[model samples]
Target: MLESWRWYGPYDNIALSEVRHTGASGIVTALHEVPYGDVWTRDAIADRRQEIERAGLKWVMVESLPIHERIKRDDGDLSQLFANYRQSMANLAEQGVNAICYNFMPLLDWTRTDLTAPTRYGGTCLRFEATRMAAFEIHMLEREEAAEDYPADVLEGAKAWFEASGEEERNTLLASIMSGLPGAFDRYDIAGLRKALALYDGIGREQLRVHYKRFLEEVVPAAEDLGVRLCVHPDDPPRDILGLPRIVSNADDIAWIMGAVDSRANGLTLCSGSLGANPANDVPAIARQFGDRIHFAHLRNVAKDADGSFEEAEHLDGDTDMVDLVRALLEEEARRKQEGRADSNIVFRPDHGHEMLMDAERQNPPGYPLIGRMKGLAELRGVIRALA
Candidate 1:
């Protein structure tokens, strides 16, 4: 595996020089300044690549070039959006960046209720509480028929949670759910978010699957032509939220999407944290099964509870078996090498690290504090070296 780190470009609290010191040879990033549905010009790609190269890091993967809402909803002029997407793929390929990671979750990207949940080691980690999310949906955003989405007991739990939360807690929960995260281009207020949810009002899992297949149909060929691998990231939290369907969650979902395009160019990002959030998803098994199709990897662990709550845990100390997972990745790499594939060495980054050390003092993005990720990378590096 080629160790990599995600950089949010020039404005990131952590600089390129800081990333280089982590001993990661590659940088996984995107042209975040470019808006969704807009073409990423070759000039911009070149400039970004130049910047990373100057820091002695190679730009190995585009973390995302977001698929526009217009395209996801099949609303508006999709042809123009598809054209822009194709152009971005071409631009990335032209700059020798092949692996592109993206997600198709509607309304919100990856979400967490608490960005400062306390860890055993006095660090802070991102956390998701199902009851809190339900509270936000039913009592906060007040989405139509939101009560039907949760179990009877869970609904009562959510109601209790909502009633207990004061003004500050409510505001914080609202911001965490509606406001965008680092690299997320969209943000919405309460009314705006409600309006956004209304658009997907009737769209369920089947319809969302259709839209995803249509997305693959439009972009896979272009990706193949440009020699770029389009890796679709799993739905964060790996379940339905805010009354929206989450199409890409489990192994079957991955199989369905991979079968839609049936090309090497159409692939998976294989995010362990997202997939592992649902205990049903066997992280190592998924890694072994889809090893060939995995284009990029986000390796982090989470400690999941029976009540559908989870917190990001130390890299090697959660539900995911880091040893077996890394071993599986190595086996996949060996297979690719034997098959003479050009992208044999997978580019993986330590996904979400706890907020600890000096990182806790800085105004770093949640899950993206510099010292925390460095600790994760160091641990991962040790595992890879030991296994190799």
Candidate 2:
């Protein structure tokens, strides 16, 4: 396995010099400055690669190339957008970066309820609570459809929580729940969120899956031609919220997805934290089952309660058996080697670490603090070394 770290680029606050000392030689990043539907020009890709190389690190995988909403919804001038997407892939491959990661979560990405839930260890971790999220939809966003999506008991609890939470608390919840991943929702507000959600009013699970399948069909050939691995990241909570459908959540979902396009280039990111967020998903089992299809991985763990709530836990101490999961991935690597596969070794990064140590003071893009991730990578490194 090739150890990697995810960097949000120049403004990530943690310097490249600091990144070099973290024991990760490769970086997982994207040209987030580029607009979603526009083509990532070869010059832009080359420039990004140059920046990483100058830092004494290789640009390994694109955490997201970001599939445009038009492509996902099957609307607008999609032919051009799809062409742009392929061009972006070609541009990256031209620059020697092969692996690309993306998520199919419509409109919003990786929604969490709490950005700073205090831990007993004195550090803070990103948290997701069902009631708080329900409250966000029912009260804050004021979506008429969301009321039907959640259960009666859940609705009651969410309503009560909404009534009890103060103005500041409500505002915090609004920001956290609506703040789509790193670059997607920086300036987003409630009106913006509702507008995005309205676009997918009638699109259900099956239709969304159809869109995803078409995406694979159109994009996989380009990836295969370029010797690139295009991996789909799992939904963060791995469940439906705000009436949005999730097609890539569990083992069956993965099976369906991998079945859509049969090629090594069409692959999975295999995020343990995302997969483990759903109690039904056995993380190690998924790794073992889809090991051949996994091109890149995000290694992290989560502590899940009975009520479908979870928070980030130390890499090694969570519902997921980290050592066993790593062992499974390593075994897969050995299998690839035995088969004489060229794209055998996988690049993996420690994801969503607790905001601990010196990181507690600085402002980080929730769950991506410097010290926390370094600690996680160090712990993961120890496991890999011991197993090897």
Candidate 3:
């Protein structure tokens, strides 16, 4: 499953020569002008891998290098942000880039109230509407106990959807849950998300899983001495909003984060639309029980709703089973090529799509447009060519 495509660099407006005509060779990106705890040097990851090898493709996964809110709230000067995230994983393993994708969700990163919702094939997806995110946390980021996190008929249907909405639909649902979309590094406005939800006042969920196990005991041994891998990334509406603390949602929080870092460069980026927007997440049995620590993949599909809403559906039509999650990721890439594993080709992408045809007149980046992810990478390349 090495077909890839998340660009967002070189000022992405869908160009890397139009993502080399969407049959994707590989290019999930990052660098994003290096900011959050800085230092991604090795000449800026070889100048974005020579601009995705001058568009012939293949940058092969970074998708993120972010994790900073003082290393997700272990508070300021976290040893200089864990030594600039272990020198950005030794400057992305000095250039041959090894899968990285990251996320430890704190003050929102991967959320939506509706970036145009509609889809009975008239196309336009991205939703997530638990009472419109509890009417943007009880009347737009007011957030203090936020009506005891909903359920008096979801806080009276979020107070009649915030009094039948007005003020430009509550400022377009507070700029669709505080702006920043494509690979979202940061963005906030209702007084910077109410001072980032008062720095997670009394941080819950076992203190954010002990600050993500002290950020994987200081960046998983510098991503296992630079052979990289590091995946993480879940919790996009997996649970608990505004009150924070969503420690990598489910599959027993990824077996308590692969038993809190017993490495093989500690992995998992299996985002079947963020753990299938939680319908008791069983996306192909968590892709065959964590398919050998799954280093990268985000194949999309959502359609959930037993009250905790969801949307984005057409990567083989939601409630994920995209052909049994692509035949359990092609039987975990034939068990990592029968155990000879040198990361036996993983890279997936086609994560969020459905803004549809001419990407509904492109404004792009909101579940990333480009003809709805080239029709979800041509329906995941015809289900990985009829299941390989």
Candidate 4:
């Protein structure tokens, strides 16, 4: 894996100089300033590339050129939207950026109820509490029929939370879940969200899968033409939250996705933290099977609860078998080398990290504290070096 760190463009608190110090050679980023549905002009791509290169880092992956909600729903000016996407691909390729990571999650981009929850250590970590989430989904956003989706325990828990939560706490939780986290995507308003949902109305899981297939069918050819890999990130928590359908969760979903485009340009992001939130997903096995097609990787772990709630775990201590997982990925890399493939490097990032040490004082984004991820990257680097 070409070790990388996600940089949130020029506005990020963790600067490129800091990223260079993280011992990562590659930078995974996007033109977040370029608004939704707008084309990432070749000039913009080149400028970002130049900035990273000047700092002695390569722009290995376009963390995303976000596909607009309109495109996801197949609503409003799709011809123009897709044209923008294709143009963005060409622009990225022109600047030698290869891997492109995007997600098909609707309404929200990777929701988490708590960003600063206390961890087992004397620091803070990100967590997703199911009951608190249900409270927001049912009582706050009031997604129609949301209560029916939860069990009795979850529903009651949510109700209790909602009743106890102050107005400010409730509002913050809603914003966190609705707004795209700093590097992920932008936030959405309830009215705007309903409009996005209207596009997927009456569209069930199978239909959404078909829609994704149709999307890849269109996007992958362009990506292949441009020598770029379009890697889709899996649904966080690996389940349908907020009544939205999630197509990429498990192995079957991956198989279906790869079968759709049937090209190396179409690939997976393989986020361990996201997939490992589900106890049933065999993370190492999935990596081994899809390793050839994985262009981007997010390595983090989660300690899952019996009730389906979870907290982000330290990279090496979580339920995910980090050692086995790394060995498997290296094996896959070895296979790729044996085949003499000419692809861009596989990009990996420490997906989320605990807020530890001085980082505990810095008001960083949830799961993105610099010190914690630096520790994770250093640990993984040592493991990789020893194995090599």
Model 4 segments beyond 4 Å from truth?
181-199
Off by over 4 Å in 1: 179-185
The TM-score ranking, best first, is: 1, 2, 4, 3
**Residues 1-388, candidate 3, lDDT per residue (tens digit)?**
7888898785567888888888788888897766777788898789889978987887998878878776677886588778878987887887888778888888667789878888886887779788878877877777767788777777888889898888898888888877534334566678877877787788889988998898898889878877888888888988887888787888998988998878878999988988888888888898798888988888988888777788888888778888888888888898889989877878888887888667767576788888888888898899889889
**Worst 10 contiguous positions by lDDT, candidate 1:** 178-187
Model 1 agreement with the true structure over 1-388: per-residue lDDT tens digits: 9999998886588889988889999999898888788899999999999999998999999988888887778886698889889988998898999889999998678889988889888988899988998898899888768888777877899999989989999989987775444344556777888787788867889988888899899999999888899899999889888888998999999999999989989999989999999999998999999998999989999999887889999999999998899999999999999999999999999998988888977777678999899999999999999999
lDDT of each: 0.88, 0.89, 0.82, 0.83
Candidate 3: residue 114 lDDT (0-100)? 77
Of the pair 1 and 4, which is ahead by lDDT? 1
After superposing all C-alphas onto the true structure, candidate 4 shows an RMSD in angstroms of 1.9
C-alpha displacement of 235 in model 3, angstroms? 4.8
Candidate 1: TM-score? Answer: 0.97
lDDT score of model 1?
Answer: 0.88
Candidate with more favorable, higher lDDT: 1 or 3:
1
